[model samples]
Target: MSVTIEILSGLGAKGPAAIVVEAQGKRLLLDAGGALHPDDTITWANNLDVDAVLISHDHIDHIGGVAELAENVPLYCTPLVAKALPHNRPWHPLPERGTLEVEGITVTTGQAGHSLGGVWLHLAVGNGVLYSGDACFESSVFPFDTPPKAAIALLDASYGSYDQPQAYCVQAISERLDQPLAFPVPETGRALEMALWLAKEADRRQLTLAIDPVIRDNLAALLALPATLRRPGLDHSIRSLLARQNACPPTLQLMCDRSDTPEQWPDHHLLHTGYLTPDRRAELAAGQISWQRWNVHLRASHLVALADQLGATQVVPLFTPFSDNALSAWHGLLGERLCTAQRLYAPSRLVTRSSLGSFACPQ
Candidate 1:
């Protein structure tokens, strides 16, 4: 049997995530992502049909478009991720780490090391296919699990060819923290890890710190999960930070992400740490705000490493600019294994059928 992969969106540029995989007369939708900005509209879900939809995480760009799909179509995601779905939407549980059968196909999941309950998906079809949904390897609290071998890999290339170490990024941000600053971040993503880091930094520098209640709640949720879900040795720090009280009229603050402007926080400058919307980019260009990356997505070197680890023969770099310079850099790094097509046919000698079996959940 042959497998066909189509990239409906999230290719050749930074946008919503959507992909369709077909094999053995069955179709599976990888992710139904919505627009990154409020003014933008998504058209990928119009008249879409599939046997099932598998969500990789709970981020808005990954699960926000679920309302557009027919309610009868089954959806699968981790229990934690299901919390972010539209109200009253039914969904089956995808293991945080284990194997299962979906639509007569073998599906395996593992930690993506980018968020609270995120997992990378591996499908058994045409040798094998892997999809890394907004993955990373340098998170201090999250753990990046090694994925199985595959012939094709759909990777998160949000950073394009920018290669910078996480330590360097932290030091750069540290240099600018002398003055009052407010960092708005995704409460479920980097906010949990950053809260712990900032708490330690505040103690060392003798500066007052404040954290949003929502972020504190997420940190509590992370602790409630199995110990293996997060990186070992950080439990103490997380607990201690949770015990501390929020500082009023603080020197620094970590709050939920929103359309924040410098003028709104007259006493503190806005410091952004993740994906910048078009409006934020404009502000950054005009020097109205400060921007620094905290390595929430895969960098250039880590992307190459993940491709090598998967033994992928055809790799599509998703969610990045496709400029000539960027393409040249990717070629230098990925060489012959690099694939830039929107549609791909990955062939293999192995059969595509697998006996259906009971599913296993992560311990």
Candidate 2:
């Protein structure tokens, strides 16, 4: 058996994601990503052809480029993620935690622990192939399901080798909450957890808090999902926060992310808690805003642990800078397992159906 993996984009930088996997004469596009910022454009979708496209989530950088693909090409994603698809775009149902055959290859889906309806994909090809789509193991509400073993692991390295724990990040952000502030967050990703945390903090500090209505709606949608979809013991907290009313002239606000500038909020300072675009980086350098990570992606230690868990022989860290210094750092961590090539050929080997039993998501 022979397999070819081509990384069309999302290599050596923090940008859009798109990868092509070929096995048994079939091509599967892992993700069709668009530009993260408004001013940017994506060329990977130009004249692209594949047997099928399997989306891992609904984030713009993952599902935003679907509109650019040919309408007849088959697409697959979870029901909740499909809500973000272009209006009336046709799609097949991808299981939230099960296996399905796509283009004569077995594909498995499981919670990515990063956002609602997000999942990591496992393709049963030569020694198995796994793709971690913006995954995290520290989400307060979402759950990260264990994936099957694979010879090649295309992992999310969005955080590079920064290995700070979530508690440290939370404490750092808490210290900055004394002043009136606005946190622009992805409504479907960290907004729900942050809203619950901010609400508690506001109550403790005797400050008023307000959450964006769109974020609130997403919380409701999350509640509507199967209990297994989320982390245990948080439904009550989510409900309590949902029942609370937004305060007028609030001291703290959790709003849906946008192209927000410091001038947009005269009363509150902008405090970013996620990925920083080029514009936001400039603002941070100019001291016009603040940024503290909220752990929506894998940290350094967690990334290594996940790679170990997957038993991956060849690991490609996606969506991060591959500078000389960065490469040296990754070498220390990944050793011989690290793979930075844009194209790779997996060792020829036949995998039996019984070996794929581990692909099942734990109940």
Candidate 3:
């Protein structure tokens, strides 16, 4: 039992990012992703040393370094997740439903319904460290299959919020089936998690679901997670289709659109984020379309309960600085249970002023 963990990349508001796992005189770097800090210090450079790199999912914040990592170490992830990675990468993939043993550590991939290839890692150290990357509590669609024997559980309590009307949100969205609703959320990660629940609700109520093509495509790759993850009692019917076809995410049946014609989609609703701004909201409002903003994060009650269930008394903030949104929120949720990020960054000072000035957004 020789494991000395170090906070590698993610510290603050950063979700499901990297960590330096050291044991038996060997170092394994977990999930190297970009930093979404206040200053944007996340560099897309190549800087890592490990036997292999294990990715939880293909989220930008989680696997931003996939291409960069493939440039170095032997990369391992679920086959679906490997496909979702950048096309430019040269990855020696360690496919899903198995373990990758390098330098005596057995890295296993478990289904983390947050996204395809979304997995939590298990390592046996002095006691153990089970790294759960961006996971939610047990639900009807997906259940909690994370390792239960972790002495040191690096759980994801991202929704460490005081409140966010989840019940009300589900009801509100369900009631708007007659009116087209657009829930323009981010095209990955937690957004997908929310979509899983919504898709199930839509199926149960016999409502059509319209989603962005980008969203559907990403979820299609993850349809195989149910077969691989046999634990936690997956919805046998919906889970069965995933193995047969991409039915649960509804990628093939989705009505993707760039227009706001609510009349045509009388029985359907669109889910997006930021795309439904005030101006666009007005245009859709008159056409039998209902517009509202819903953020899916964890409530303080849920966070504490999750932490308690994981037997975690000390919760560490990852990928964020000292003054990150997640850390600030956790103050109210965990208080004494909260822990500070290990090493933060200040990338601007390291580079030249001219080099920084040339950083302009492409049109």
Candidate 4:
């Protein structure tokens, strides 16, 4: 076999985001994440032997098993993710768009637009393989490089054909905010985007925006990173939001914890944003709290379009398990190119010459 790809985990919500890529006499683990089974968290990554680990982001599901990796194994990630890792392993900071040759395999990183330091990988073995760690193409606050072309693409399909745009979700949340609004979001990832959007909204409406300690720190970290990772005016806007926090005005507050019970804070317009789980839906039903589902992963239409744009001959779905409806939607677009992760995809194709190109994000 010229190259073989096995989905060790990360097939569904319960699975961790881990895939083993074997080529050029090297076994590269895409992400050392752990799976969340019904009763317990399973360390499926422990079973895989790899030469190196490539982290897509710092999200728990994407980097949970990093600490478990042996110290000698090299861990590669973007500078932000490399710095954020809790482990003291040998971490290599991968330059965005810079190629790294490891054991004869060529790998490059590109902006993922999903989190503060997330990136997608373009691997050149025989044919190219692009692994998109949890990614988002609709982010207004984050900088997304153009999508790179590859023969095979392992993409994030968490939302599965749910095509609600970010603008719509932001507008929906904004419409309900007549008074002070509070959003309880994850410490990283989409939370940063939401904070920036809220800051912009506050500026537009001439209101004060307050950020909890966690968000305040995360914003600072994002600003401290190199300028290339950020879009222009993002730092300035975040700083402006911080400056207005001291003055009392109609504010949108960022709460890190669930202690900000909307039922008790009836005076404030509580707009809790996160994945709409059963518990969250119940909480919204129990009180006047409004829940808005913010999707950070690609929708079905975007996923298929991206695959076609990248010139992918084969596409593997990640994040959530694809339903029949989801598969049908992809089949309509990809036809034979869309392949679900039911078995190993070991291609016998030989290595073709690669001409590196970059993707330019929509303005």
Model 1 poorest 10 in a row by lDDT: 354-363
For every candidate, C-alpha RMSD to the true structure in Å? 3.9, 2.6, 11.2, 3.1
Model 1 vs truth, CA RMSD: 3.9
TM-score of each: 0.95, 0.96, 0.65, 0.87
Task: Order candidates by TM-score, high to low.
Answer: 2, 1, 4, 3
- Tens digits of lDDT, candidate 2, 159-208: 99998888899999999988999999988999988988998899899999
- lDDT ranking of the models: 2, 1, 4, 3
**Model 4 has how many clashing residue pairs?**
3
Q: How far is candidate 3 from the true structure (C-alpha RMSD, Å)?
A: 11.2
User: Residue 170 error for model 3, in Å?
Assistant: 1.2
Model 3 has how many clashing residue pairs? 20
> Which whole-number lDDT from 0 to 100 does residue 351 have in model 2?
52
Which stretches in model 1 have alpha-carbon errors above 4 Å? 348-363
lDDT of 2 at 234: 81
TM-score, model 1 to reference: 0.95
Tens digits of per-residue lDDT, candidate 4, 115-197, equal: 87788887876567889988877775566665556788898888776777777887787787667777777676777777777
Worst 10 residues of 2 by lDDT: 354-363
lDDT per residue, candidate 1, 8-43, as tens digits? 999999888999999877899998999888989999
Better of 3 and 4 by lDDT: 4
Task: For each of the candidates, give the backbone clash count.
Answer: 0, 0, 20, 3
Ten-residue stretch with the least lDDT total in model 3: 352-361
